[model samples]
Target: MSNYVIQADQQLLDALRAHYEGALSDRLPAGALFAVKRPDVVITAYRSGKVLFQGKAAEQEAAKWISGASASNETADHQPSALAAHQLGSLSAIGSDEVGTGDYFGPIVVAAAYVDRPHIAKIAALGVKDSKQLNDEAIKRIAPAIMETVPHAVTVLDNPQYNRWQRSGMPQTKMKALLHNRTLVKLVDAIAPAEPEAIIIDEFLKRDSYFRYLSDEDRIIRERVHCLPKAESVHVSVAAASIIARYVFLEEMEQLSRAVGLLLPKGAGAIVDEAAARIIRARGEEMLETCAKLHFANTKKALAIAKRRK
Candidate 1:
């Protein structure tokens, strides 16, 4: 097992606690705030603002929080490709991205949008950029314009089906790859006889791993494919796709909130856990299967909170 240690402020520690809420272990060491045991790594946080990471993937997980560590170990696939910077954005291309993977209360949404060369400047004029930079209201405002202006396809994997897939041992990465691929295929077919110059996917995995994940799929769209990190910056199509995916995810979350008679927040934060406990108290545990991703660590955390509240 590998070992890594870092000192973090209380704010960072609290953020870590929220991020790892689902992975919380009951067996806390004396003076330790929490311990988390994942398949590849074990993490422990202490009151002194120190965090320890162990196990095979310790460095990989730790790299996320330590800026230089990620830069030093960055893989080629994570870098924006030359072709993407020089040509892909200005050419007719299909750009794909996903949203809601990190949220505990919404469906995973994937979208692919086709933006032709001439329309690039027009799309940019709408302030299309990374979805992370825009609020829900902005996403709502811009997504419909993008839809009206471009040909796109979206896939939404709701919580029940997502839970079922997780229970059956489907990794989230594979699920995303499948969704991106399926949506790309749909968009390609929808715009038949008009072949795109390229297909760019906001890189989640290495290019080889992405193809490996889709190796079992019957229909794989591989021609002119480029996987680049921060793909939205590389092309306007990706930005549009990100906005549309977020818009759809927001719509789904609103509908689910209405169905559950409670406003479901985004992200896996303390608020999410509290909201989940409320649902369990008011609606029962089974209601979560219909509305929340059951496999998230939030499920157990919420159950514990609900039980304690009783």
Candidate 2:
């Protein structure tokens, strides 16, 4: 009943053809809007110029509107998220995400996952969305389910290692880029055997900077890599990736807390000051580097407080 019209120019139609390929309900006419029914069904009208698809099918339809058919199957071996554009008209996809960059404790984590066309509904069924939108328990419950439904990879940069990298001159943003890129590379390699055509990543930086960083790494992504804002909301793979990353971050934080015998709070803030004091008292200041990210101003401030208390 929820009808929408998508105007197809040469480019849009070409994209649609590639996305739908053998799957289109009918050929589209010029200057016609595609009518789509909600929840995963597409109805096509040649005279009216409308298309309807649901779930994975709907995603495929959207993708066609953007990149055209030529690019659709080109990366079929790669997952959808890795595709150059996310608007293709298929269900198979993959996406990547990271967490803990702003936290003064625990590890920085990057996660990636492959969502096949058939599994989009399964993911949505599990209430998969952006990890930030869900609490820790919800993420934990959903993470294993996501893993079961999709192939995934996660990279964790422990606080100590992160500090070492920072001391060696890597900025946090650069470090994040490095971790994300490396995770993506690994994910791509993992999914390449299956031969998906595309992947999408939430844009962390401007287009030029992101491309520059990718170029600097000399790592070529075979599948198309679509970069956009709020990609997690638009792409199921990205959403699944975010949940996995957040789950790992929370789990790691708990482990860090147990290792230090105190709860390590999330983020850099005044409460972190108290936690730092506790860590310094229980462990030595020298040990702080092992347990905390030293680059944070919180580390220096905590050290000063520790000295004052002494």
Query: Which candidate comes out best when scored by lDDT?
Result: 1
Q: What's the lDDT for residue 116 in model 2? A: 80
Q: Using Cα atoms with residue i matched to residue i, what is each candidate's TM-score against the true structure?
A: 0.74, 0.72
**lDDT scores for all predictions?**
0.86, 0.69
**What 10-residue stretch in candidate 1 is worst by lDDT?**
67-76
Cα misplacement distance, residue 225 of candidate 1 (Å): 0.6
Error of 2 at 161 (Å): 1.8
Candidate 1 at residue 127, lDDT?
Answer: 93
Q: Residues 254-282, candidate 1, lDDT per residue (tens digit)?
A: 99999999999999999999999999999
* Candidate 1 clash pair list: 22-297
